[model samples]
Target: MTRNKGADSVQSEASAVNAPRMTDKDFERFSEFIKREFGIKMPPSKKTMLEARLQKRLRALCMNNHAEYCKFLFSPKGLESEITHLIDVVTTNTTDFFREPKHFEMLLSSVLPDLHKRTNRPIKVWSAGCSSGEEPYTLAMVLSEFADKNSAFDFSILATDISREILQRAVNAIYSEDKVEIVPMALKKKYLLKSKDRKKRLVRIAPELRKRVDFRQLNFMEPFPFRDKKDVIFCRNVVIYFDRPTQNRLFNEFCLRLVPGGFLFIGHSESVSGMNLPLRQVAPTVYQRI
Candidate 1:
């Protein structure tokens, strides 16, 4: 067999072209930019993951290297769209219905009952960093069930995420069948509608339940625009991306937005310990504004 030296050379060049050659300086620059803008800490250990994720954006723009992509990202021409694309690529959106089930249990067994007894006003709940609509819809289902029995009770849910793509999905209020598997059977039956097209294998949140949630795109680094305080804030699993200082500042902000005695529910793996915030721990990963 004759050796195809030309083909071998071409293949070698192609592999080299595809491989990421991001420099340490370039990685540091990106790490610093993301931390400053989004408060997401990306240390040297995440260099490979960051490169892998950002490669998609580079390919989409037909950029050749990390330096060129970084230059474009900082240029006037790439300010708006490129920045949003970078954020979407870097931000984590892992969420599901009834995630961290104990928090929901606490809300049902303890928090809502106390709020109902204390106030006749409409309840306001904020599902901060509510990715792809799961958390807020879960809140709505639970609150809806509560409201059905307590005829005078009324409530609204505000769902926010930094990713516009995720916010749109939240607004659409559609989900895969598997995504709703964690929802209690009774609540699922009451609140979810199977899509008419069975092949889609999708479910839609009931119209009434969907109407109760308002989805918005927001970055926690910026100032919040809430005029009225929230009775409950579900920011679970969102702050894991941020560092301690960022988490402290964000928890304080959550405290300010919460009504006195308002509930704050974080993820199972998270805590408010040693933060010196105004919240008192009421249950595992559950806190109340003091």
Candidate 2:
């Protein structure tokens, strides 16, 4: 009465489809863990969304249902292997090269010149939550342009994300041609390399610029591993997922991590008003460390 291998897989798929929707209790378990471990708020409204996202993982693991997935996710084995992946899946990493263009304009106009004048040391810029490498590579091009003009100006870029999966994408520094259209033509000409296979329509950040950025995995919920303070930090659009207290604490840490007179760039849609942090609003969604 044993089923054939194909029959077993078909039955498995059917059972997975017929599996009960994630229960209220299971959703709470996931939401609580996400909030505690990643500082990401997963309200009840996100239950359906979370359920959908995790379904793929079940298939990958050959799991039949949410219960089995939850069992493994809470186990110690999951902590080592699945925790970060869980966090990664829940995130929607929407980013673009040269996004919020005003920030770069400010970088060229004030942040760069000011920081460079303050010290002869290589200017340190950290692109927190840098998704798929756009922000950091854009930085490389702009900073390189500035250095060409000012022989004495030197800089370093640190780009980090919570997802190892996304960090790998950043390190690869490759993008579809469309992913880079926002990049200006002259800069694109200087900093992007076309794929050998033209039909693929792919481009990679020039090797020279790729060498300038160091990509790493960083979770805001963990202690920051900075050995030296940063001169400028771009954490734009990242704190919105955190609750107010988490956001406050995270910014306070960013405040402490910056050298005085350093810059912090947040998302245009986000605000830090009324927080007692030592930052002054210098432009729309841009702040200077006091």
Candidate 3:
């Protein structure tokens, strides 16, 4: 008995196609690159997860394996465009309207009320790491409601994220009906427009609310460029991926950007623990700049 030559050739090709060939060194280099460039910490335990996420990019670029992809990524030309794709692939954009409702409740109940009473000047809110416009739009809806009653109170939102792709989506201001389900009926009616293509199940945010939010591409690793300090900064669920040192640096930056006694809202799972930052916990997951 003997093996057929054609069959042997096919088997060899299949094995090469399906093989997991990302070396430990390759993983280490990519991990370091992510941490240094994006402030995201990818430990050894996340190697499998990182490989899985990057596999799609490898296929899209017609690369055979992670090693080739890594080389391409660091190449001069790849650094310009491929790095954007890499960040888009590596970062998570999981968000919904009114996510972590308690924060919004606190904003309306305590933060906004106190700020309104403090001064008659315009209010500034920064929605850092605002993915897909949901958070900022939600903020706008809440602020709009307050303005409707007060008449004289004015506010504006700055929504920023590192991923250009996500920022574009946010500017489009289109969302699925399911994405807006958490929005209260009155607010949804006021702020959302039912798309003409009802079959597509899409909703576009009203121009009034959309215009209040200024969406921009921003990397948190860089210095924030704003002349005016914010009355509130919403950086929720964005820094959970960073290590403690990175978190500390980010919190300090937030403090510097915020007005004295301004508010900072983070994810429920995140904290300012172990860091003697200039922020005091005013509510669960809510901090005020000192």
| Cα-based TM-score, every candidate | 0.92, 0.92, 0.92
Estimate, for each residue in 251-280, the C-alpha lDDT of model 1 and write its tens digit: 999998999999999988887888899988
**True-structure lDDT of candidate 2:** 0.90
**Deviation (Å) of 160 in candidate 3:** 0.8
Off by over 4 Å in 3: 1-20
Tens digit of lDDT per residue, candidate 3, span 17-79?
Answer: 785667899999999999999999989998888887887788788998898998988999988
Error of 3 at 195 (Å): 1.3
Which 10 residues in a row give candidate 1 its minimum summed lDDT?
12-21
Off by over 4 Å in 1: 1-17
lDDT over C-alpha atoms for residue 218 of model 1 = 87
Which whole-number lDDT from 0 to 100 does residue 188 have in model 1? 82
Over all chains combined, what TM-score does candidate 3 have?
0.92
Residue-wise C-alpha lDDT for candidate 2, range 1-290, written one tens digit per residue = 97799999999899668755898999999999999988899999999899988888888889877888999999989778887679778887999999989899989988898888899899999999998888999888889999998878999999999998988988988899999998999998999999999999999999999999999899899998876899999998999999999999989998998999999999987889878999999888889999
lDDT of 1 at 102: 78
Clashing pairs in 3: none
Once model 1 is optimally superposed onto the true structure by TM-score, how far is the C-alpha of residue 66 displaced, in angstroms? 1.3
